[model samples]
Target: MSVILESKSSRVCINEKGAEVCSFVLKETNLEYIWQADETYWARHAPVLFPFVGKLKGDSYTYNNESYTMNQHGFARDMVFIVEHQEKDSATFLLKSSEETLKNYPFHFELRLIYRLVDNDLTIAYQVETQSEEMYFGIGGHPAFNIPLVKGTNFNDYYLHFAPSKSRFLLPLEGAFINLAEKTLAQTNTSIQVERRIFEKDALVLETKGENAFSILSDVTNHGVVVSYDNLPYVGIWSPFPKEAPFVCIEPWAGIADTTDATGKIEDKKGMNLIHPGDVFERSYKISIK
Candidate 1:
């Protein structure tokens, strides 16, 4: 099932399966900013990553000395979410822990995704609450936008412009695991031209010390998107590997993939967030059409 939200300038469609944003269209120019899931390259629009981000060390982790298995990016994205509330330009979807989720995640929790549209910007907020003594998890946003943005431009014509920052580093991946040896992606410089080879190794998981914003811009056209986040510690830029897909994903991550030498313990996982009993965790990011 899907829900629609509209503003004076834009129309957005969200699927209930993942609470994923399937389409974001600017009304003025009839331009669709979100990627249409074309399976030849990638078949997802904007998927919500929860309980885990990226890949596990061995696609399994131990909790209390008992081994449990989970796939890359966790199970939330494939689960059905109930429409909890809705208004003209905003809606909330809720996912409560189920028997199916507990077999792997082992938690009694509720996850909520709240989306709001204001003018040309779409804000997505994530909330998690758990009843267990403590919950360890990761969460993130994987939103892929059309690269060309405008009809006349090509994928290579677009580049990513970062907000001014002191330094930025990328945690390079060895296959699906993180390589602790960080590489300097930029130093005061703020722009990287889009290219196919940059993602040859996979998503560039970035850590920027001072800024949490970036944009997709093209030299040939004025159409683009600005992505900004709050409380997200990592940012990932990715596209389908070796496929030259027509979309680019700007991800905001609260956690990251397991390290190559990960201990196989969920509690010891790098970048995992913990919430104490009766507490709630929240994070958010925004996409603005320009």
Candidate 2:
């Protein structure tokens, strides 16, 4: 069933059949910024893309001498999950590993998404609990926020501003993890071009310095949301969106983009998290409008 829960401070919407947002829109400000995409597909709030998910070599990969076929993004973001529980400003949703998924992923696990609203920020927390010792995989969020921006505005007027601009950033090659191609401070407050292909070369990796905090802003004003990843290694600015929509995504990833160097084995994938059997791992990100 479709569920929309609201608290005095936030709102959590779960498509149950698709992905359940722990907290997307907050009761704080003008952030009712969910996309109008039909619930039948992806609903614009950070999508949880994961697990040997994401486009792989020829849309195929090898594991233990066997090849597996799966979509680029994981199935969690693509299925109707069960509403495990909820209360006020928080909610928990789950999806079980399936026989169908076992064909490609080959693991038993429970995925949970918990959202909470605190102060002026809306936090999306992702948790993965492993039920098998087989292998663990990659996970990330693809939340597209409305630019609150206008059309005709060239990406040249936009600058990625970090509260702690002195912090280091990562270098991700087209389809790879957040490793240092080079490390440097984000001192640039100028326009940069926009293109979907940029992602093709590799994600513009950041040097979070264990502090996943940053923002994508327009030269127009001080208007933008401050993104705080729970020490996430990746935070990206992407609008390469068609002119029809003034939307951009500030992605917080525990994982990184896949690369030509990818070893094909999910366990061999760079930045792949290894959760001990029965261990539950959790990560989160917060977005506060300034």
Candidate 3:
């Protein structure tokens, strides 16, 4: 099932299965900004990554001296979320850990995703609460939007412009695991043009230090999208390989994937968080369709 939310300038659809945003349409232009989730290139729209983000070494992790198995991005994306509350332009979906989840994650916790629509913008807030004495996990977003948002524009015409920052390099991923081999794309922060081959090595995980927001713009088209990831520690840009896929994902990650030489321990995984009992972790990111 899916829920619909509308604002003066936009309309959105959220699937109850994963609380994933399936659609985001601009009312003024009648254009869809979110991906259509075609199985040919990719099979998902916007999936929430929880408990874990990216791949685990050997597809398993050791927790409390015991091993648990989990795939890339974890199981939250495949679980149903209950509607906690809803209004005309906003909704909240909740997911609590179960025996099924504990078997793989071994932690009691609650995950909530709140969607709010205001004019041409949508904000997604993620909140996690720990019920166990200690919980180790990661959380992130995987939202894909249509590239060349305006018709008649090629994918390569669009580029990502970041806010000013110090020199940085991207940690390239090999089969979704950090390659450890790095390269500096920009010395003083600049726009990185979107090309067909940029994603040949998988998503480029931009180093998070002093980086926050970016705008997806085109040289000829006036239409684009701006993403603001205020507190996120990392951002990922990706698309379907070798197909010149029509959509692009601008991800805001509070945690990241395993490194090439990861030790397979949940606690030692880079970007994983540890939450004390009775504590809450809250973060959010915003998207504006222009």
Give me the candidate number with maximum lDDT: 1
State each model's CA lDDT, in order.
Answer: 0.90, 0.62, 0.87
Q: List the RMSD of every prediction in angstroms.
A: 1.2, 4.2, 1.5
Model 1 segments more than 4 A misplaced: 183-188, 209-211
Between prediction 1 and prediction 3, the one with superior lDDT is 1
Model 1 quality (TM-score): 0.97
Residues 121-220, candidate 3: write the lDDT tens digits: 8999999998898998899999998987888898888998887645556777878788765545544366878897888888878776643777889889
Per-residue CA lDDT of candidate 2, range 145-224, in tens? 65553355554555556655454544544433333444455443333444444445444555454665666577675556
lDDT by residue for model 1 (1-290), tens: 99999999999999999999999999989999999999998899999998899999779999999999999999989999999999989999999998899999898999999999999999999999999888999999999999888887899999988886446777888898888875556543657899999899999888755447789998798899999975778988999889979999999999999998899999899999999887879888899997
How many backbone overlaps does candidate 1 show?
A: 0
lDDT of 2: 0.62
- Give the poorly placed runs of model 3, Cα more than 4 Å off: 181-188
Candidate 2 regions exceeding 4 Å error are: 9-12, 20-31, 38-43, 52-54, 149-159, 167-203, 217-223, 241-244
Q: Which ten residues in a row have the lowest lDDT in candidate 3?
A: 180-189
Whole-model lDDT, candidate 1? Answer: 0.90
